[model samples]
Target: MPRARLHDVAEWTADGHRYRAELSAYLPRPALATGGPVLGTDVDLPSSWWADLREALAATAAVATTRTTVRQQWIDRHFTRLLGIPAPAIAWTTGHGDLHFANLTGPPLVICDWEGWGRIPVGFDAGLLHAYSLLRAGTAARIRRELAHVLDTPTGRAGELVALAQLLQVTARGGHPDLAPHLARHAERLTAMPVP
Candidate 1:
């Protein structure tokens, strides 16, 4: 829906912000997953798929952290409030809101579950996808390639922040033991990044 609405606007004016704000208002909040579902139980996607997913997450993170009213401190506060746990000292960005492998389908694979979609950091989706991809090995290069392609595009850079932010938010909230170790690693990677 965010993409669809974004595409609907042809002119660049203050109205665009109004439209985006309206879209954010209309969008529903995401439901808490009781237990994080199996990350890649449904999809037979290749490891290379993580590249595109990572790019998208990063793009979103960049937009949210840099462009939105929300700041990293605010994001941490909200995350702590929402998850009932002290927020990890990590950067935040806009998120896909609810990103899981199941949200993706079809050839060229479209992502669904836009309830959590909003401003985030560049690595949000990348971290989530990386955590999920941990069960497999030798696919990181492919994922990196796709991300490089995205970073080369204008929107790609913008979306990167949002994606990373979302990735951090979701992993913190989801509470999957299976993912804990992977999350820790990705979180470390995110924390090490030089703020863009």
Candidate 2:
């Protein structure tokens, strides 16, 4: 898959602030058609677009990643809030690691930002995508429907539990405050586990 080509990277500090920058070739396409930034958007993607994404994900599955973006102990620790007994046993596979709307483009369906790409629990990519769609109920539902094969299993649900736990951890560190309650509610629904 053709992507924005990286040319150079440099880091420097100025007075009291530190900065890092990288230059990469630009894509002719706009960023994801989904609104912008971290905002939720109800993007109405076509079936063809979904098919392309599935194909791309299948390709992603073929590659192996040494990077373990999140350690098991950290995941299990936070997962206690959701599953109450750590993440359930689940399959594992290569994934984009960050499969949210911001990393995905529409029309041509080009995925960007590969730095976080790595091995994750099976269904983790779909689970992370669904997690990001929570604010937009319709988009979230569409993701579930499109990836039911992955999101509708015990193992798949475990993968989602981990993903939600990670999101909640991010929320704790000050992010997406509006998403906290929703994430908690969904976590309870998934595991019926008591939150501490």
Best by lDDT: 2
In candidate 1, what are the lDDT values of residues 41-151, reduced to their tens digit?
Answer: 334445554545555555555553334433566655454343333444443456665554445543344555554466544344543454455544434434445556544
lDDT of 2 by residue, 72-160 (tens): 77775667764466557767778888888887777778887776678788778888888777888998899999999888987788788
Residue pairs in clash, model 2: none
Strongest candidate by TM-score: 2
By summed lDDT, the worst window of 10 consecutive residues in model 2 runs over: 31-40
Task: After the best TM-score superposition of candidate 2, give how far the Cα of residue 11 lies from its true spot, in angstroms.
Answer: 11
Deviation in angstroms for 170 in model 2? 1.1
| Cand. 1 Cα-lDDT | 0.45
CA lDDT of every candidate: 0.45, 0.77
Backbone N/Cα/C clashes per model: 46, 0
